[model samples]
Structures are given as C-alpha cells and as structure tokens.
Target: MPGARLTHEDRGRIAAWLADGLGYAEIGRRLGRPTSTISREVARNGAPVAYLADDAQQAAGHRARRRKPRPSATTSDGQPTEVVRGFVDEFATLLAATGLPRMTARVFVCLLTADAAGLTAAELVRRLQVSPASVSKSIGYLEAMALAVRQPAPGGRRERYRIDDDVWLRAWQADTGAHREIAVAAQRGIKIFGAGTTAGTRLGRMGQFFARLSEQMGGSTLAEPVGYDALTVLAALVHAGRPLTLDTLATALDWPRDRLTAALDAIQLHPAIADPLVLRTTEPETYTITTRPDRLGPAQRQALEDPGHVR
Candidate 1:
C-alpha cells in the first residue's frame, strides 16, 4: 500500500475541483501531496478537457522511466551564463505578470537569451518541454504581436524561428506611433480635464514628443548601414568571445544566411583577408580574426580601400 498513487475517484475529484477553479494548493491539500508535485503531475499528464487518474499515473511513470538529466552545464564565474539566466528569469516573470500565456513568454525568453538569434520550433519543443501544438500556438501569438520571426537555418531543411533586434525597435517605435494615433483621445482627456490645466497640457505634450521621436527613430533604423539588430548580435558574440556559426550569425544579423555566407566567402577568396582571419568551422561556417589578423591590422585597413592591398 506504500506509495500508492491517486485513484480514479481522486482524479475525477481533482478534475471537478479544477473545473470549479480551485487552485493547486487547494488540490494538494485534498490529495496530501506537495503543491508543486501535484502541479507537475497535472502539468505533465492532464489537459483541459481530460484529467484521467489512471492515465496521469501511467504517464508519470513513463516520464520517470525516460527522463534525462538536464544539467546546468554553464560554469560558475561565467558572466554570460549569469546574465542569460537573469534575462530568462526576469522576462519570464514579467511576461507572466503581463497576462501573456506562459508558453508564449517562454518562446520570447528563449530568443532574448539567444540575444536575437531565435530558436527553431524544434529547438523550442526541446528546450521548453512543450508539445508541438503548444509551440505552434505560442509562436502564432508571438508573431501576431510582431515579437518573434522565422528565418532559415544554414544548410538545413528546417526553418529556425527568431526574434531579431528590430522586434524591440518596432515595439518602441509602435509605442511612439500610438502618440499620434489617439491624439483625439488625448484631446478628449485634455478637454475633460481642461486643456489649459497642467495635467491636460502634460498629456498633450507627451503625445507630441512621442509622435516626433518615433519618426526620427524609424528614419534612423532605415538609414543605418547595418541593421541595429545585426549590430547587437555581433557585439554580443564579440564580447562573449564565442565562435559563431553562420546560422548563429545570420539569425543575429537578421540577414539571410546566404548573404552573410557569401560575404564570408568573398573575404576568404581574398587571400589577403583569409591569411589573417581564420575561418573557425566550415559546415556551418564561422570566422574570427586570428592573431595573424591582429598583426595585419594596418595592412587590412589599407586593403579595405585598395582591393589589391595586402602586405
């Protein structure tokens, strides 16, 4: 009788309790398991329409049998590891507080942790421990909000979904654009509160400033030689001193993989550049300036202007 699982009656009762909108703690009290254990068991096995006790028990057993250890592989004193975890925990909490679905928040958080090189749906399924259906639905939610995107992976049949630098830029710009959209609404608020009054004038000014700033930012994004999104990813990779694959670079740049790949190829074809800058890998190619590159800095700079110039 030891370690006996919940019975059929217990499951139906839990289902009834959930239907009645009882919280997990309340259910735990009734079932004599810890709240988290109850939560996990239900999360692993039960769906909205069905919460069969026998099925849940069997599912839990199967999971325990097959579960793999997900070790925290990042080492201590690794600043990126710490920073990434901070970003993940903070964003996940914020998204939940904002009433976004948990899965949707998770997808966004994944992209953020990657610093704009978003994951593929397959990656999402593996990392988030969610079903394909949930990932699909969550991605749709993200896409509708323009918070996520899909881009091609290098040398691959599968497309990798991503959140580029522009996602945040667009969100900021959208907020700024809203200032112009509902000026009438602001005016109405102004009138109700009295236009000349301090609060109303402040509201009116806010609308004006936002409208102006949005236009400036939008133009800046367009005029910049490199997309701000791409720049950000490059900065992160360089800062981390990590080797970057073409897909990683492409995702970060928000450029097509082929375009960046072609650029790298051009650089390599020029023995001047390739001799100094080493390609890290070829399959999903990456490059980094070798010690040789450091030594050739002056020559490389001159060669930038003169194609034949490599000393």
Candidate 2:
C-alpha cells in the first residue's frame, strides 16, 4: 500500500485512544499503521488537548493539496508508489540526522518540493498545517543557513519566499564562510590557550588548514560559461540575415530543446533583444537581429550580458 488514508472516523478513534491514555505505539497497533506515522500525524495536526476529527480532516485536505504530484500505479506493478512523498520523507530523515529540528526540516523540505516556484510565510503555514509562529521560526532558521531567499511577488504582488537556482550555491558559500570565521576564532584561541601547550598546537593546525581552504575556494572559478558562448550564437544569427527559429537554434546549439527554450526565454527578457530584435512571428516563433548597428549599440549588447544592467 502507498499509505492508508485517515478518515474522520480514524481521527475520532485516535482521540478515543488518547482519552484512554494509550501510547502512540498501542494506538498504531489498533489502527494498523507504524507508530512513528501515527505520532507524526497527530503531533502535526492534533490540538494541544484533543484531536478534533473535523479539524484534523480539514487540515489533512489542505496538506494533500500542497503535496507534490503522485505517480500512477497499475496492476502490472502490483504495488503503489508515492515516490514524491517517499523522497520528501527521506529528505526529512536526512535533515534530522544533521541535528535540525524535525518540524523545521519538514517545513523547508515542503518548500523544496512545492510546485508554485515559491511560497510566502502564510502559505507555508497553510500548506504545512503548522502554526504561524512555527512557520516564522522555521523560515528564520532556513534563511540563516542561506537555504531560502525572499523575493518580491511579480506585478507588485505580496512579498514571497522562493528557492532559486542559486539557493544551494549560496548555502554552500555560507557554510564555507562559517568555516573561515571559525578558523579565525581558532587562531585567537591558540593565543589565549598558550602557544606552548598541546591544545594550542592543535588549534594552530586547524587555523592553518581553514585559512588555506578559504584561499583555495576564493581563487577557484565557477564553471559557468562566459557571455561569449551566448554571444557566439547571436553573432551567427546576425550574420545569417534570417529570423532564427527555435528549432534551428536548438539544432545549432546541439543542446536539448527544453534547455534551448529556457535560454531563449532568458534572452527574450533582455531589454536589448526587446529593442533590437523585434518578434517577427511567435507561432513558428522567429527573431531577427536588426543589422542597424547604430540602433542595437555595443553598450546595449553588453548590458544584455549583465543582469545588473537590465535597465
């Protein structure tokens, strides 16, 4: 079974079990589920004093809506799989191993799996079936780790939090930064602990290693392609003198169609493209890089490469 569905009736039974002062394991025996599952279910949705069946059902419904899409199963397999939920459960378990609070880990994991591309603090509370205070604390913890970021909602909408492409990269950077700071502190500790002592010698070694690590990371370059790769494609398109179609662009780049589409979308967002390469057709979607160099100036082309200069 993928999982047993908890009905309003089941919630009432759970309440009765609690009233009888039965432990979660005993309750699970009666309910035919794992004790840990029952404990998590009640702890997440039940009230402080009681598990109101109606309220619990409502909360569960909301949570179900927020979950990642489930895969279909058939008689051929003879087993149903809630792969998304399984992955999320494993992710939560991994976070718990890292010493993160279970509730905090679950909340952040939900954000990672959400399909809306982002969520606000309020949405997180609704989706996680958690308290506002709990959601706020979880968000603060994630932000401190640099695992999440806040962004303005599109078209002057509410402030929202999102997991972007740079989210994991920034988190790694923050972790390294912490190590660098600790190294500096260790050096100071060596002086305080007395340079003649064994403890001082160990601390000094730690300081040296981290200082070297920090330097190496600083000098290392990311594998990101320079604007030259993108410019090369644009340069060829300009010389070809015909509106470049999406299919042609994909073939020329020798990359997947989805990747090419993403690139095209990013390029279309560029103000330089908006001014110089007007969309001639969108169905067989084609773009022409205007030959008028004066109109599409070098400054504008450079601006397209710099996101900071997206005026």
Candidate that scores best on TM-score? 2
- For all candidates in order, the CA lDDT equals 0.61, 0.66
lDDT by residue (tens digit), candidate 1, 1-311: 00125555667677788788888888865553346655775777766356666787677577668988664545233545444545654577678678776556766787766634557788766555456776788788888777878878889888778877778877766655565566556767787888789989887776555544544444444423334433344354556576777777777668786666555554443323333234445344655443443345576668876967644
**Which residue segments of model 1 deviate by more than 4 Å?**
1-90, 115-117, 184-311
TM-score of 1: 0.39
**Model 2 root mean square deviation, Cα atoms:** 20.3
Q: What are the models' TM-scores?
A: 0.39, 0.44
RMSD (Å) per prediction:
20.8, 20.3
Candidate 2 backbone overlaps, count: 0
